[model samples]
Target chain A: MTMVAQTGANTGVQGNKTPDPAKRAASWRAVRRAAITIGLALATYELIARTGSFPRALLPTLPMIVRTLFAMLLDGSMLMHSLYTLYRVLFGFFLAMVVGIPLGILMARFRRVEQFFLPLVSALMPIPSFALVPLFMLWFGIGNLTTIIIVFYAATFPMIFNTWSGVRSVNPLWLRAAGAMGADEHKLFWKVIIPGASPFIITGMRQSFLRAWIAVVGAEMIAASNWGLGWVIFDAKEFLNADIMLASLAVIGFIGFAFERLVFGSLERNTVMRWGMMRSAKS
Target chain B: MPLIEVKDVSLAYDTPAGRVQGVLGATFNMEESEFLCLVGPSGCGKSTLLNIIAGFLTPTGGEILIGGKKVSGHGMDRGVVFQDFAQLFPWRTALGNVAFGLEMKGIGKEEREEIALQQLKLVKLEKFANSYPHHLSGGMQQRVAIARALAYNPAVLLMDEPFAALDAMTRDDMQRLLADVWKTTGKTIIYVTHNVAEAVYLADRVIVMTPHPGTVKAEIPITLPRPRDPLSVEFLDHQKQLLNYLGQGTSKAA
Candidate 1:
């Protein structure tokens, strides 16, 4: 009986698309459900915190963590830590771009460059950024330099690989067309090759930033920088200041999310997405 | 003297199987304001010949003379319209794509843009001047490509089956537009195509060639009036004549 009913419903939907209003309503409901689900989880966590399954000191409640975060912000310590993390990440990321972009372009454009760099990049790429934290700390000392170097090392490979493939995979027909249209080598590179490879380069930057963000936090934990969200969390572990650790973790996550959504989002808005090499997500 | 002269041009490629010729001992000439089409089956090396004329390829044999000057490499004088409509950089607006050639020549941006807009008008795409290539339809993209190829105002235009990718309706539209562009510009053109109807419609003269070591088989001139009807008796007669030549070329080759 249920099978027959299901078959009848399937037949009803087979020939007709779900109407636009229904689809929009369904999506709106989904958003509402997601918000409700998150609220419920937080409520449950708060309930558990009050019940005290574990010590209040080790497992601080959400409110305590929020208060800690607010107090730290008021004192400007949180801001300073965030700034330190941001500075290190940006500097190292810039270094990666400086080395990776030109190297990638050369590798793609010239056979000799590819022959030299490919093996080197392949060998260096597989070693995780955390694996290099000790080595980098040894070389650069335990501070911003070590953290920044780790970020650079983590970020550079993706940038290079993406740019290399992007340039190489550009439409050959466009090259010939541009060449036949009387474009010189310099003109061709700027006009055709660069724009052609930009979408991939942008993607490379996004991925590189993501990896660098992860690497910076881990490097800070190991290298124990005087200031940074990562260092705060690590420092909090000693005092059993779970509230401070949670607060710092929140800040780190927020920064990563903000950079991914806002910074790279606008970069994409201005470049490849605007150019139609990439499609916009929302209808 | 002819505006462009081809003297026994040939290209050979070396493979594991040894030497293979792309085009062999092909000699032709184009007078100023002439509309010539290279028509044959696939692999006839018509495109190769067009590329050589465009100076994208240097022929292993013979010389291509433009205004009695030996062709060395690609130059602005030869504007090529590829079969795939490889105009309009994806990153640029329609106007920007057209302006690319002028910009390369070191023309000021404002001046080049004005000229680009003019060429866009020539292709009836001035309204879409700011639109990227992806936003435009395939037909529109080809029109923009034509506009770009002409914006630089090349002395000779080399087209390699520019309409082959379009739908039948769009193809006809393109052919009419191309004919108008040709009559207006009076620039020498060397077009390559496999379609007999296309060559018959747009060209002043058609050169048919055979495949497998490509060479011209026949040169047939169509003296039909402007806006030639595809269904007309005279048009069908020319098509028949070209078909016969194509069949004969195949049989003789076999």
Candidate 2:
């Protein structure tokens, strides 16, 4: 929606030109540059593998890794592992969202809540989620329970921190204006406070998802479940199946990239971008 | 009863250094549909007084009555337009922001939008109803703020230097637009400003407040006709009187 005015202005400036052709050329330039960089990197890797500087079993060529990835997908084992991992991550992320958001809003609104939670969040935040994995494994036992808990632990802190600051940082002027317009406590929270604080809260969600993704992979590797991409990579390492390991790594990277671009990107486009609180990078 | 009556209202608050008196014994009365202005130098507490009457802040002493009822807290009857435009919600379209007060008043969605669009038309920005606040110019944004404040049909509108941020040409245009709106709406306006010329141009009566526990020094009635030229001799005389009143306060402080 924010782009509507800008789009009109651009078309007017271009006059007779369709606008799409020039825009398409600029995007094509970016794609060609990226393709050349990727091609060069792949060629270097293939050259190094051929020279045999390291064990071929330890460092599989890019073609071998791609083949392994295709084979696993055909057999459906990779899909199953991915589904199991997604289930754990989503569950843990959901739990974090449920707890962190309300807790943060409460902390911002009330002095007592802030006093109670601030010190606790600070002390606990410094301890990494992976450090808690060994302890959680001891407590919850290996498998889905430990993995999910670790993801939850990783995701919760950023959610709380961002939301707390978001609510606090709400423009005082808007709050005053709303109050002046007859907004009661309930109306103030819903109309002014929530929308005003939304940018920070959305940023917090993005961060929480990123943390959850990383935590799930690491926890799956250490907690070694029967089915997970991380587990497959670690298991493949023991058998010197470098190709399998590399394939899983590529899948992990692809999934992370997809969530970041497709999910959070669209979320941003719909909310803050439309609101004019944030502009998309190119525009 | 006068539309608004302020009887010896005062306010004090504590800062890190010590206690500060925001206002003291600020007394006045505004008749129905009266255009009143509070003018003084910085630290004069004119805005604080306006805030108190708006019921956004409680007076630590005395009382304020609106339509002869003692003001308790912010209500639907008294709408406030703030300096800095206090920002229209960036997410909401101009129509949505204007409709906000109606929404709080619990008007149905369609009905509120209808009223909001009408108010937008009043401000002459009807075409920008779908535009977000950021997309509009500063002057347009302030017009939307005014439309929003006026949407719920408040008896009196409280303004805190509403044109302070605009450029001189835009500010002048806004003042005339506001004066026209005031005539048609017939809403009692308690406008706060530091500009002496502005006080003479728009106000029916100027309450020249003295600083350091800001209180009204004198109330000068503007007998000048509407569409009164700011450059006219009579207008200049009124401006001179306001300047002297303000000068008395600062010179006394010195």
Candidate 3:
């Protein structure tokens, strides 16, 4: 997921450098290839559905899936489910950032802080978020709490690790230069350290958000939160409503793609790219 | 009283081999607005001595004084330029970087930018005010650094081989620019370099240092006029004299 977002960003940067006609033709080729691939996949699915080799309920046609998606949208259940999922993921992501960024900076700057947190973070980071879902479900009950906690757990490690590395890797020469220019500790951190470390911090945010997106859905499925898109998919499995399942999956994929492309993409453009911290990534 | 004084300053640290002295009893004094250069071979502790004066490192013995006050740590009165091109903040445009020292002094945005622009003009980098550090060439970036160091009006400027990374042509241009800045600002500068010709070309007085527990070896004064040519007879004589001091230092180390 991180690699996908990075490559997407890389191409966007490269698009500026390519000649106009060549760039236009390349994009048009990409659009045509995408259309053909989607069209072929839908046709194959529809053909298999008509064969009736599997039950009609288990393998719905494209029209049936589209109709179910539209009905759910018109009645607002799909919107509510999406909103619920977004809330959980966003809230958990926010919590991870608030805690992880400061902690990481502290760990990097102070020896004692690094000593205290390094061991604990290392021990906890390798434990997958899903492994803790059952334990959280027992502790917090099968609802928003368990799901949000899982997302937070999934997101926090990357945030902490990336921020830590970013802060640590800031060139020492800048620090000395800033100090010699009469920057106190507070000024140094705000002006020199934070801006210098911004590239890694931004990358950490992207990675953690992707982690939270994955964790929220999986947690919703297991914790049986009735309102989320993940719960809808899991609920449809019992009733053999594969059309609803496919519709929910499509919505999930679309939202994740939108956030990755629009939200973080603009963020990179504004901060790191504008500042020239990401020149190496363009090639 | 001298404008700046280094009194028997020394730095020693224990390594796996044993105690290694960085600078041993290095003592010197500079008059106000004087252009001083420390010239030596590698590991001569010229840089270490400059770092001590910049307040980045505390000497284990002796002390430094600026304007009759004991130096403790980094202060706004002194500005330092490092050799590394990465010394400039990558996030800031040339203007913002030049304005950083003023910002640290709590100067207002409008005024600081105004002063920073004037300093950039002094370095002839007014046209690149909007360009980021990475976009600038090595020599241009060093010029921005010089602008930044001068913006806040530091009493003394410390330069650690600021043009060491540039090509010969760029280095020559930078040397001329630096000499112009020194004359215009009238700020005392202590420049560190291993290049004998560079030291002779720029300094009013060149302090030659010896390596292997470094100490001051010779202090040769160059009274050549401004815009001195490097190939001129007197300039070559000064270079040859400074090189002799450097050669003696290395031979003693061996």
Model 2 chain A: ten consecutive residues of lowest lDDT: A8-17
lDDT of 1 by residue, A197-264 (tens): 99788778888888899999999998956798888889888889999998898899889878775677
Across residues B1-254, which tens digit of lDDT does each residue of candidate 2 receive?
Answer: 78899999999999997988989998999899999999998888999999898888999999999999999888889888988854788989999999999988899999999999999999999999999888899999999999999999999899999999999999999999999999999999999998888888899999989887788899999999999899999988788778888884334432
Q: Residues A1-283, candidate 2, lDDT per residue (tens digit)?
A: 2323333232222122236887667656766876899899989988998888989898888888888899999999999999989998999999999999888899999999999989999999889899988999899999999999999999998889878989999989888878877788999988888888888777777788888999998999989678998889888878999999888888888898687656766676677777777664442
Instruction: Judging by lDDT, tell me the better candidate of 1 and 3.
Output: 3
Q: DockQ for all models, in order?
A: 0.66, 0.65, 0.77
Model 3 Cα lDDT, one tens digit per residue, B187-252: 999999988889988999999999898999999999999899999999877887777777743344
In candidate 2, how many Å is residue B82 off?
Answer: 0.7
Best candidate according to lDDT: 3
Off by over 4 Å in 1: A1-37, A281-283, B16-18, B248-254
Per-residue CA lDDT of model 3 for A1-283, tens digit only, reads 4553663554363334346887767667866877899999989989999998998899998899999999999999999999999999999999999999999999999999999999999999999998999999889999988899999999998899989999999999999899888888999999988888998888888889988999999999999557999999999999989999999999999999788767877777777877677742433
Q: Quick one: best TM-score, which candidate?
A: 3
- Per-candidate fnat, comma-separated: 0.78, 0.76, 0.90
Error of 3 at B114 (Å): 0.7
Residue pairs in collision within model 1: none
**Which candidate wins on DockQ?**
3
Off by over 4 Å in 3: A1-51, A280-283, B248-254
